[model samples]
Target: MKEIFQQYTGFIMLFGLGFFMACKHEIPVQPAPENPSNNNPVDTGQPCDPNTVYFQRDVLPILLSNCTMSGCHNATDREDGVVLDNYANVMATADVRPGNAGGSDLFEVLVEDDKDKRMPYGRNSLTEAQIQIIQTWINQGARNEICGTSTCDTASVTYSAVIKPLVQNNCSGCHNNSLASGGYNFSTHAGLVVAVNNGRLVGAVSHAAGFVPMPQGGKLTDCQVSQIKKWVNFGALNN
Candidate 1:
């Protein structure tokens, strides 16, 4: 991708800022998935685990989702001398200390108790799990490892484990009660159910015609989208 966006973190990175808001006011008619020649899924090897943190799959998403918005850390908007949209930019600007999470400016600010100093600025703090992911990545030497899930097991998808966290990391920034970009609050299960029932959930992610192709600057891997589809097809339960 021309931008700092990655192919794997595409799901998290898909949470583009500004114009690419999730389920915005435009819930157009859901269309069928388009079969573009280059839209094929790529095999990214084994599933990523906490013991190892991949930049593309783990760290970039959080940064892109929360930091690379229009006026924050994008190339156009270097808020506070920090640019986090891409891996190189992050390394060059995010002040990451190779083996020291506490010393790394990027890691330090995430855990800051002061809301004014914490990253993501005005929004809610990232989940503890999210914060820990970054800490681990930094402490592990902040390698730009490309660890992606090659085989997407769409069977038996669960909401709590897979779906909720996915949305939290990828979509909730603009679709929450505070922002409600399109009169939708994806942070809540009720709002998610609404999207599922109206086919917006699947339509948007699948890049089906009539729906906004998301991740704004990036694209989601076929595996991630398939897992979502599997969950919706079976039943978008709160479980």
Candidate 2:
């Protein structure tokens, strides 16, 4: 009876030990979670104000759009001893009294009423909005600043909505009717078509091989380039 009891107790112990060993080996171990912040960094700086007149973003584009042309304020031209192509050149060359748009010669020519000498030589006058932006920039001391701002959406790109404005802000200064650099005029849809037909538009804007990269001092953002390609691929229409 004592031997039988010992055998039964030993069998129970062995069963319990086998079950513990199976559980220890069979259970799957989970890995530790990764820190998302470490993998992809994000900007935590202050957001840019939409109303503020940023020099590099707002003023440079305006100057590049309305000034800097073949016979205007471009480096080679430097008409009337004024070069509006860069911030340093603009301050030194043009008669600009910072914080005084009314007294600034640069602002004066923009608002000049005399059609014969109203600046930009002969092309269309600057939009009222454009004038106000420049005036506000001058009033704000015309500081050379770059703001942190970025927003891009290519969901509904169109010629009138996207391409025209993009070209006007970046390319019109050199390729308008007054300039026509390299025999290309981007002022009108008809004029733009010539470049599109000859594959210059895509090549130039994309900074592709053998074609001149556009926007001179800077390259287009990936978003802006995507917008241009979207418009062009959609038949480069007058839409």
Candidate 3:
């Protein structure tokens, strides 16, 4: 009887050990942690301000400055048989569809990867803000509508307040450290002074004869031109 009890006890212990081993095998194994790397993500930046994006005020300026400049998409050159100088011409040739920026050839070429295919080819690319403005304009119906509320505060116009923002927004895409189209840099006061001394600054903005109408996609608003004239007449001070 004692030998029989010892055999039973051994059998029970073996069975328990086998059960434990089976249970261990049945449990799922955890995966190893992912290794870290230095692949930075793309910066999409902030969503565009839908309320303030107007075709004439925001979008046209970008097109003019970057796309319609001489020897580019202007009426004179009409590269690829596309003229972006005016609203009708742009709508006709650019394949701009209202409410669809991605589908529009104009917008697509602005962000194109191929150097030869991109708009403003062989020049500085547009900024995120500028691109977003165009996107928002197209999404908002690509109308010929102007910003009715836009008012130039000619009374308080100062270099830092008015002129700096103007140049930075409208001209700096090509005139900054990157491209500086026509060797004319409007990205700094000194550069602007050089243009001013040569009389190109006023002539260009005023769209006068013997000078290229600047901000190339379109002319500056009458108010904006007047304010710029005031600044220049006031000694173009660095205030």
Candidate 4:
């Protein structure tokens, strides 16, 4: 009887141990929440101003790079005694006609009907987009401001890139070693420097004071004139 009692007691203890070992602690799980409003991440806004024409930053650079080449509207052609290579020249010509494109000769030639009458002769006329810009500026009163400020220091520039090519392409044709126009030769750097310092080269471009506006009558763009002025202001560095 005593042995059976002992065996029963041991069996009860073992069962309790097994039950405790088999049981496990449970952890609560939660789902990650989603952000419904943040579908796109970038801000959208207008990039450029639609009004207020920028002369120095926009218009001047365009004219210099595209319009004022050697055989084009440069001082060489002297076309219409108009030179676009300076602030005074461009302002002196652009008109303030609200919708009339014929207010200025510049606009007139740009929109001319006959091929010979059109500017950029023997070439495609100014695009509608370009004409629109000029017209807009003209309509905006054609303000002329040098350096765009009363005392803004002009940026320094070089001669080789700005002035040399201009002289070589336009003036050198008639003022080179073979044919020295007005007893002048711009074929060499030294020769050019001499003429510029002596006021002859500049004189040639001045309508009221010089021999003649170059290329016989064409005009250079404003940027070219600015570049030349900057170079001269910098002592006309050869490089």
The candidate that achieves the highest TM-score relative to the unseen native structure: 1
Q: Once model 4 is optimally superposed onto the true structure by TM-score, how far is the C-alpha of residue 159 displaced, in angstroms?
A: 30
Task: Score candidate 3 by TM-score against the native.
Answer: 0.66
Candidate 1 residue-wise lDDT, 55-107, digit = tens: 76767767776777788888887898898876677777877777788988998
**lDDT (C-alpha) at residue 148 in model 3:** 35
Error of 4 at 150 (Å): 20
Task: Tell me the TM-score of model 4.
Answer: 0.37
> What's the number of clashes in each of the models?
3, 0, 2, 13
Question: Which residue ranges in model 3 land beyond 4 Å of their true spot?
Answer: 1-50, 149-151, 168-183, 207-218, 233-239
Best by lDDT: 2
Whose TM-score is higher: candidate 1's or candidate 3's?
Answer: 1
Estimate the TM-score of every prediction.
Answer: 0.75, 0.68, 0.66, 0.37
Give the whole-model CA lDDT for all candidates, comma-separated. 0.74, 0.76, 0.74, 0.55
Question: lDDT tens string, model 2, 96-154?
Answer: 67678898888888889998888766877776877888898788776665555566778
lDDT of 3 at 93: 78
lDDT of 1 at 175: 74
lDDT of 3 by residue, 59-154 (tens): 666777677666778888888899876666777778787778898888898899998887678776777777888888777676665433444578
Worst lDDT run of 10 residues, candidate 3, spans: 32-41
Superposition TM-score, candidate 1 onto the true structure: 0.75
RMSD of every candidate to native, in Å, equals 19.6, 23.2, 17.5, 26.8
